[model samples]
Target: MKRESSLKRATTETDVSLALNIDGSGIARISTGVGFFDHMLTLFTKHGKFDLNIEASGDKADNHHAIEDIGILLGKAFYEALGDKAGINRYAFQFTPMDEALCRTCVDISGRGYLVFDVPLTREFIGDFETELLEEFFVAFTANSKMTLHIASLYGTNNHHIVEGIFKSLGRTLKTACAIEAGNTEIPSTKGIIE
Candidate 1:
């Protein structure tokens, strides 16, 4: 069976359509109006080796709505694609470095939703994207995806590099966490059922 999902969400603030294929070559076609955000999502798809397609539009004067909504839709797609979460690794952690920046990400594909983000930046904006919106995106994603996710920028001087490291680490961690373990036909939980 193909582990894939597609979702569409429209609200007063934004409109988003997204698709995800968990087992796929790294291929992305994304357009969210915010160029920097698009770059980050592209990197996320590429590093995770996940096929992703997203088209989003919103109040461009304020990017927060669009960014957060995209995360929600993407997370919903992941949740749908994962299905029963059986035979999966379920937990993964990774540390990624980009130039002078380093980020660590840990993911648990639990049925509960939670997020711990620790990214400290001195700047407020990265081009057209607001730096603070990153946390909002992750919060929405975690809430919708029902995953426990932790992301921390251990050290970084440049905002761009820090964000990039976070995204890359997130991608790698999610990729490992979602992988099916060989010959494992049961959920990776002690309670017999993950959900």
Candidate 2:
């Protein structure tokens, strides 16, 4: 069974489409109006070894709607792709470093939605992208995917490196969490069900 999903969301503020394949070589084709966001997503797909395609358009006067909606659609895709969450690891964590930045990320495919983001980014913006919107993206994703996600930037000075590390770590952690473990044919919860 292929773990894949395609999703679309259309609202007055934004229109977005996304496709995800959990099991694939790292490949990405993303075109969002936000350049920095597109870069981050590209790195995420490459690090996670996942195939992803995203096409998004929104009111460029303010990128908030577009960024959040993309996160929502991406999360929905993951949730749909996972199905019953059977025969999977269900939990994963990773610590990634880039230059002067280090970030740790943890993911749980629990039927609950939660996010704990702790990043001390001193800068307000990275080029055209507002740094604060990164949290919004993760929050939207966690809510829609019903995932327990924790991301912490242990130490960083450069805002770019810090955020990059976070995304990379998240990608690696997600890959591990979604992997199908050998000889584990049951849901990874003691209660015989996940979510």
lDDT of 1 at 174: 91
lDDT of 1 by residue, 155-177 (tens): 98999999999988888999999
Candidate 1: residue pairs that collide: none
lDDT of 2 by residue, 17-77 (tens): 9999999798999999889999999999999999999999998578899999998998888
RMSD versus native structure for model 1:
0.8
Off by over 4 Å in 2: none
Model 1, global lDDT: 0.93
Question: In model 1, which range of ten residues has the least summed lDDT?
Answer: 186-195
